[model samples]
Target chain A: MTNKTPLVELRNMSIAFGGVRAVDDVSVDLYAGEVVGLLGHNGAGKSTLIKMLSGAYGADSGEIFINGEKAKIRNPRDARRYNIETIYQTLALADNLDAASNLFLGRELVTSLGFVDDDAMEAEMRKIMTRLNPNFQKFHEPVSALSGGQRQSVAIARAVYFDAKILIMDEPTAALGPQETQMVSELIKKLKAEGIGIFLISHDIHDVMTLCDRASVMKNGKLVGTVDVDTVTDDELLSMIILGKHPHQKEA
Target chain B: MSTPTTNRSAKTFFNKLGIDLRLLGMIGALVILCVMFDLITGGRFLTPRNLFNLSVQTASVAVMATGMVFVIVTRNIDLSVGSMLGFIGMTVGALQVYYFPDIVGLGHWSIWILASIAAIIMGACLGAVQGWVVGYLTVPAFIVTLGGLLIYRGAMWWVTQGQTVAPLDPTFRLLGGGADGTLGETLSWGGGVVSSLVAVGLILASRRRKANHGFTVKPMWAEGILIALAAGLVLGYVYIMNSYTIAKGALPRIAEARGIELTEGLTLYHGVAIPVIILLVVTIGMTLISTRTRFGRYVYATGGNPEAAELSGINTRMLTVKVFALMGALTGIAAIIASARLGAVDVGLGTLDELRVIAAAVIGGTALAGGFGTIYGAVIGALIMQTLQSGMASVGVDAPLQSIVVGLVLVFAVYIDIVYRRKTGA
Candidate 1:
C-alpha cells in the first residue's frame, strides 16, 4: 500500500487563530483501504487539522493532495467536489428537518421540474438506514427527536450514501453505548475493506488499536509521530500521546 | 388514560389529514375571531361586503407577511420592510404620476406593467443592498434594517419633498382594487374553479407519487376529505367575493363607463380584487420557493443550524442575501397594492407596517428562533390581525384600545406557541 501514491496526503499543514498556532506543521498520509487514527487531548489540534482537510477551515500553509495531485479545497463544497465527506463531532444534522432532508442536505435529489424529490430521497434514505442502522424507524421525525445513536447512524449514513472517497469521522463512537460503538467499529472495518481511505479522530486507545492501521499522535498543535498499529503497544501509544515523545524517532 | 388516548387519536387524525397542527390552530383562531366579531357587530362582520373589504385590506400586508416568513425563518428580522414599502411605493407613485406619463404620453396601457416591474426591481436592489451588508459585511440584520427603517422613511419624504402624489394612472389604480380593480363574476368563478382543480390536482399528484415510491400514503377517505376541504375553501372565498355587490352610489358611474343603460336593480359583483389576486399568486409562489425549491431548503437549514448548513456545503451567506432580496421584492408588490388602492402616496404610506407584518408572522406560528414557518400561516396571520382591527372598528372600539388589544394578542399568540411547542415537544 505504501508503494502506491497515497489516496490523500496532508503535507506540512499549519493554521493559526489570533497568533495561536492551532494546527502547526503537521503531515499525515493515508492510502486506499487504510484507517489512520488521529489521537489527541481536548486542544491537541487533531480536530483542527482534520477541519482544514474537510474545508471547514483553510490552512495558513499546507498542501493537500488527492491521488498524488494537489487539490483546492477552499470550502466544504470544494471538499465535496473532491469526494471528501466529514461526519463532524456535532453530527451536523438540521434539527427541524427529517432524516431524509438531513441525509441529502446540500445535494438534494430533485425532480425534473426542479422541485425537491422528497419521496425519492426518503426512499433512498430508508434503504440506507436499513443497511446502516436497522433499528432506525423514525424517518418522518425531525432529527432533533432522534436518539444519540440514531443521530450518529444518520451522520454516518450521510457520508456513506455520498460514496465519499475520503471519509473523515470525528469521534464517531464518542456518543455511543458499547453495542453502538461495536456497530461503528464493524462499520469502520467494512468501509476499510471496500478500499475507502478514512481519517478517524479518536481519544480511545482501544478504538485506534482495533480499528486503525496507523496511529498518529499530536500534542500542542504539532504531530508527535505516526506509528504502525501492529508495531506499537497500547502503552507506547499512550506514552507518545501523554509525553509528546515519538518512540519511532528513538528507533531510527 | 382516556384523555391521553383521545388526544393521541386526535393527533393521528390530524396527521392523517396532512394538516400541520399549528396551521389548524391558526385557522381555528381565525374562525373564532370572525364569529366573535360577527356577533359583536350585530351580524355586520361576516357579511360578504365586509369580507370582501377585509380581504382587499389584507392583501398588501398579507403579501409582505408571506415574505416575512422567509425572513423570520432564516433567523432575521427586516425592520426596514415598512419603510422599504413606503419608499418603493413613493418611487412607483412618482414614476406613474411624472415619468411614465411623459414618456408614454399618459394613460398608456403599458404604464402599470412598467411601473410594477420597476417597483419590484427597485425593491430587490434595496433589499440586496441591505442583505449584502448583513451577509457579507457581517452586520446584524436588526441594526442594518433599523438603519434602513430610518433612511427609507427619510428617502420617502425626500421623494417630491413630502408632497403627496395623487390621481395615479387609472390603469395602475386597478392593481389596488376598487370596483374597477375586480375580476367580476364570470372571471372570479373561473378563477375559483381553476384554483380548486389545481388544489385537488396537487393533492392527488402527491399521493400518487408517494404510492409510486411505495411510501405509506394517507387513506382514501383522508385524501377525499382533504380534497373536498381545499375545494370548499377556494369556492367559498369566490362565493363571498361575488356576493359583495358594488355600492349603489358607484353603480351609475360604472354603468356609464361600460356604456350600459341604467336599469332597475343593476348590480355589479366585485368578485375579487386584483390586489387579492396578486396576494394569492405571491402566497403560492412564496410557498413553492420555501418548500419545493433548493433555495427554500437552504434557508430552513441555515436557520436550523448555521454551522451544520455551512458544513453541508450550503452557501449560507448567499442564501441570506437571496432571502432578504425576496422579502424586499414582496414588499415592493405590497407597495404597489397599497399605493394603488389608496390612489395616492405619502410618507405615511407604510407607516408602522413593520410591526404589523412581524406581528402577523409571529402570530402565524413563525418561530423567531428560525427554521419554522408556513406561507399560509403568515397569510392567515395577516387576516387575523386585519380581522381584529376591523372587527373592533365596526364595534366602535376606540382606536387606542384597538392598539392595546392587538399588542396583547401578539404577545399572547407567541406565548401560546411556546406552550404548544413545549407540550408537543416539536
Candidate 2:
C-alpha cells in the first residue's frame, strides 16, 4: 500500500459486556480508497469490532486512529466528526419522510429565514440520486413506499451527503434480490471512486469476492488474517474463518 | 393522456375525501336528527335561535377537543383536562373577585385576559410535569395522565372547598350571552357573518397553498362544493335571524332573540360569546402550527419512531415536553371559556370534560396509535358529541341512554379507524 497513513487503524482494541469479551485485542489497518470485507461466524465478534470503529460501542482497551491521529469516539455524534458513518442492517431512514428529508435527517439545509430549504434540498437530492443510481426516480414519495434497494440508497445517500470518509455497511445486500444487490454494489463502486474507504461486513462470500478489495476474517474475537481478494478464492476465505489459518501458511 | 390524467386525479380525490367522509357522516346524522326533532317539536328544533345556541354550547368542548387532537396524535392522552379546567376556572373567578378588584384595579376585559393567561401558564406547567414523567422518565402516558386526573380534581376540591363560585360580573356574563340578543341583533348578524366568511376563506387559501407547494390537494370540485355548502348555511342562518321577531321597546320588531328574554320571540344573543371567538382563533392557530411548521414535523417523527428521531439528532425529549405544555395551555383556554359562560367557577366546572375531549379526538378520525390526526377533525368530533347530547336531551333521552349511545359511537369510530388503516395498509 502506497498510502503512508491508514484512514483508520485499531490497535489492540477490546470490549467486554458482562464478562463476555465480544471483541478482544483485535487490531487492523484500513487504508483509503479500498473496500475491506469483515467476515466471521454469527458470534465471532466481527460486528462488535466494526461497531467500535463506528462509535456504536466504546472499546475497553487499546486505541483507534483516524488519519494517524488518535481519536476518542464515545458516541455516534463523535464518530460523525471524524467522518465515520454506519448504515445499519435496518437502514434507519425515516420511512414517513421523503428522500430529500431523509437525506438530511439530522442536519437539514435551511434558508436564511430559518426554515428548511425545500427547493435546494430537492435539487441536491436529484443530483445525488442521478449520479449514484439513475434508476431512482421517486423523489417526493416517502421512503416507506420505496423498494428495499431504494431505501438503502436513501440511507447511503445520507452518509455520503455528509462526506463520510470511513463508511461501515452491515449486510447491505442481505434481504435484496440480485438486481437490487447489483444496484447497491454499483453505488459502492461509485463511492470507492470518490475515495471513500468502506468496511463491508457480510457473510455472503460472493458479495465480498465481487465488491471488496481485501478480506479480513475474525474468529472468537480475534483477527485470523487479511488477504487480497484477487489472490484468494472464496473457499480459502471460508477455511480461514472456520479453521483460523491462512491458506498460504498452510501451503508453506 | 388527458383521460389517464383525469382518471388519476379522480382516484386521488376520492382517496383524500375518504379521510373526511367520517366527519361528513357525523354531520349528516346531526342534520337528520335536527330534521326529525324539528318535525316532532313542530319546527322548533330548526329555529334560528336553537341553532345559534347549539353553536355556542359546542364551542367550549370543541376548543378543548382541538388541543386533545395534538395529544392523541402522539399516541398519548390527557385525561386531566376536565379537572384542570375546573381548577383554572375557580382560580380565575377567585382572582377576578379578589386580586383584580383590589390590586390590579382592572375592569372585566382586563381581568378576563389576565386570568386566561394565568390559567394557560398553570395548565402548561402541569402538563409539562406530566409530560416529563411520560417522555423523559419513560413512564406510560396513560398512567401519568390518569393520575393527573385524580390529583388535579382533588386540588380543585381542596381549593374551592367543594363550593360553586358564582355572581360573576355582568361584563363577563355578556361575553357568554350578550351576543345573540334577539336573533337579528347586530352582534349576531355581523359577528356570525364575518367569522364564517373568514373561516371559509382561510380553508380555501390553505388548500390552494397546499396545491402550489406540490402537495396533493382534494379535488377542486369537492372543495368548491364544500365552500358553497358552508356559505349557503351561513347565508341561510342570517336570513333566519333577519326574519325572527321580538319586542325591543313595547313594539314588536324583527330582531335576534336574547337568551335571557326568549318569551319575546326569537331574539339572538346580543353579541357573539367571547369564548366562542377565542375557541375559533385557537383552533385555527393550532391547525396551522400542526400542518406547516418544523415543530409539527418533529412531533410526527417522534411519535412514529423515537429512536430514529434521536439518532437523527432531533430533540425528541424537548418536543414531547413542548407538546404537553401546549396541551396544558389549551386546557387553560378551555377553562376560561367555560368559566366565562357559566358566570362562575366551582370544583366541578370541568367534570368529565377530559373523557369527552379524548373521545372527541378518537371519534374525529385521529388514530390512537399516534402520527396521524388533525385539530379540525377533533373539533368536528367534539361537535358531534355535543350535538348528539343536545339532540338527545331535547327528546328527553335519559342520561344512561346517552352514555350507552356515546360509548357505542366511540367503539364504532375506532373500528372504522382500524378497518381504514388495514385497507390503506398504513
Best prediction by DockQ: 1
CAPRI grade of model 1: high
Ten residues in a row with the worst lDDT in model 1 chain B? B253-262
Model 1 bad stretches (over 4 Å): B1-5, B256-261
The lDDT values for all models are 0.93, 0.77
TM-score for chain A as predicted in candidate 2: 0.90
- Model 1: per-residue Cα lDDT over B157-204, one tens digit each: 998899999888898999999888888888899999999999999999
Best prediction by TM-score: 1
For candidate 1, state the interface root-mean-square deviation in angstroms to 1 decimal.
0.6
lDDT of 1 at B38: 94
For candidate 2, write residues B134-195 as lDDT tens digits.
Answer: 88997888899889989888888776687777766555554454343232356657766786
DockQ metric for all predictions: 0.86, 0.30
- All candidates' chain B TM-scores are 0.97, 0.83
Q: Each predicted model: what fraction of the native A–B Cα contacts (within 8 Å) does it retain?
A: 0.77, 0.20
